[model samples]
Target: MSTDLDYLQTVLPAPSARLAGKVVLVSGGGSSGPGWSIGKACCVTLARHGASVCVLDANLDAARDALCAVKALGAQGIALQADVADAAAMERAVQAVMSAYGRIDILQANAGIGKVGGPEDIALADWERIQKVNVDSLLIASRLILPIMSKQGHGSIITVSSVAGMRYLGYPHLAYNVTKAAIIHFARMIAQQYAEQGIRANTVVPGLIDTPRVRNTVAKMFSADDFEQAKAARDRQVPMGRMGTPWEVANAVAFLASDEAAYITGTELVVDGGLIGKYV
Candidate 1:
């Protein structure tokens, strides 16, 4: 018998080749510290579903590590280091993927950063950094890739947002909240504008997911230094009595990236383990 923790750690293969022959580009496809970050899990999950993956991260080592996992699944993939928020770097990154895979069928704009402060308390620089990484990067990626996707006559753009975007999660991080909300609408706008061009756009909103980034940043905020306490507190907040895993979020991305979601567009997929639905 397997436990939930076992399930969370395991990376399951696709039930079908729903994404066969497709190419996927995932930004921020690396963990901030260790374990499976959401973007890394998306890269692996897309690869598992028969899509060639390109793992792009500012950290070269992390990107390479993710690519290794993709290749281990017997899927074609490449790793590159680029700042997703830098226009020139992102353009170059997109071109590199085109060169290696010929075309990009899916773009997972997953790069994001969070700071635990309200507008009044947060440093101006921190606010700008959060916006650039969490919001501007999505714009840059979409602006560059939309034309190519239009030419292909079909593509999928999955931007990662958060439950923080939807509502207050008992946090005072104004910048982070605003950026996350912005991406949700950004995807919807693209979804409508490019629908005729055969490009689909959607947002994946995850809540209280147990990832390295959260452990390093949010755990400290939640528990005032105790990791286990942070985890327990977050778990109790969720209606399901636990935080979600990156793999579960990746599963949602994989679905949106596949043809199975052909008619789905201009929407947000909330992967919060029922937290978003229950009243506090």
Candidate 2:
């Protein structure tokens, strides 16, 4: 039988030149807890594929770290700090990108936070915070960039969503789920409204991603043995028998943002290791 490492090597597609000479912006392009997270992976992957990347995060230090990783790959990258929910800040970020690279070709809206709470128990403040960061931020950022992209005559916008928005994932985060669902719709609307303008918008949905955020959250929710057991059960649910890594999701984002996916828009690319296909 082939090992997991061998399977990954054989199954994963290598980076392509689909984004050659493009300028891409990745919000939340930084490590949130530990190791490389989805946003970080996307920044580096886009850079490796020949795009000059602008890594933006609320945490300047983390953004710099991600930019360094992209540079280490011998690709062009820059770090920018901005609150995704703030329109003026996002406009400033766009200006910086334009000054550095002349034009933007791709916009990856990936900033978000996860808090577990059901409707009855979730605080209004918490719900608002999640909505602002997860949904409003994407809206504002896209609003700022749409004109720039429209003037450029072409662009791609990719939003990162979660499987929770599509189906139950044994989590009780109502606000998070709602915000993600809204994001998918938002992308669809943008795709249709701007199709004639040469702009494409799509969503990349990831399921049970094995990132630091998931690890820490799971650790807080379950005992060590229970956590391991739960992870095993989650793996069993996936046809691929494992949770996907950040790089896996990053590859999907790269494709959706690149010219390779020019004919694709207003659709979802699920990178869930086949977990979303399982009924149970």
Candidate 3:
């Protein structure tokens, strides 16, 4: 039987099966477009490291696509459809995973949405949607998964936040910042509350990552009719002289989700290449 263990050993030449035998549930674990996304990349990386992953996304087709990618890479995976913003949908999704996998070891809450509006232009509805997607979904996923982890005596929970949570980078989005900040604080609190129960929680704060979902839309926000100009401007803001990639963010997540970070919790891992170093 060539398990994910065999695949990892032969394929990557890596020294360890970091997540061997673990089951990971990743919400938003699919690409919104044809390219790599933080969620999709994280899911694949976890699979590569020997984790059996459940790829959940609001889009069923995207979820299936991501699962197929994992399978193609010789990893175990399944597809699930859930709108993270919806409580019932998230609850049902969690139930589906429990029914299929019987237990959850790692969960990466990566579903989030950004609205392009400042305080004055922000609509109450859009703000609520952002809260539901970014903040509420995290809470819901934790509530549903923590119990199983608590019973099993161990688990890791990871939340994907943003550098915008700390500082604005000429972007005028109020809800995104607020919700992202909320995710970090909430994750810290969860970490403290569950640390005694053998459960760990952490947040990944990414800075200026070049991903398909946010680039063009953010370009519009910065009044860059030219997307390349937006990319260039963002590159200049990073100390590395370039914006980070989705894989970088995903790798951070993969590490956190693994036993490698067993003693780490309640902290924010900043994946920014010195953006906050200069600004904050």
Alpha carbon lDDT at 134, candidate 1: 90
Better of 1 and 3 by lDDT: 1
Worst 10 residues of 3 by lDDT: 1-10
How much is the lDDT of residue 11 in candidate 2? 35
TM-score of 2: 0.92
For all predicted structures, in order, the TM-scores are 0.94, 0.92, 0.91
Candidate 1 collision pairs: none
Clashes, model 2: 0
lDDT for model 1: 0.88
Error of 1 at 18 (Å): 0.9
lDDT head-to-head 2 vs 3, winner: 2
| Deviation of model 2 at 233, angstroms | 3.3
Candidate 2 residues lying further than 4 Å off, grouped into runs, are 1-15, 224-227
lDDT digits (tens) for residues 20-119 of candidate 3: 8889999999877776678887877888788889999999988887787678767787899999877788888888888887889999999889887898
Q: Count clashes in each candidate, considering only residues at least 3 apart in sequence or on different chains.
A: 0, 0, 0
Q: Using TM-score, give the best candidate's number.
A: 1
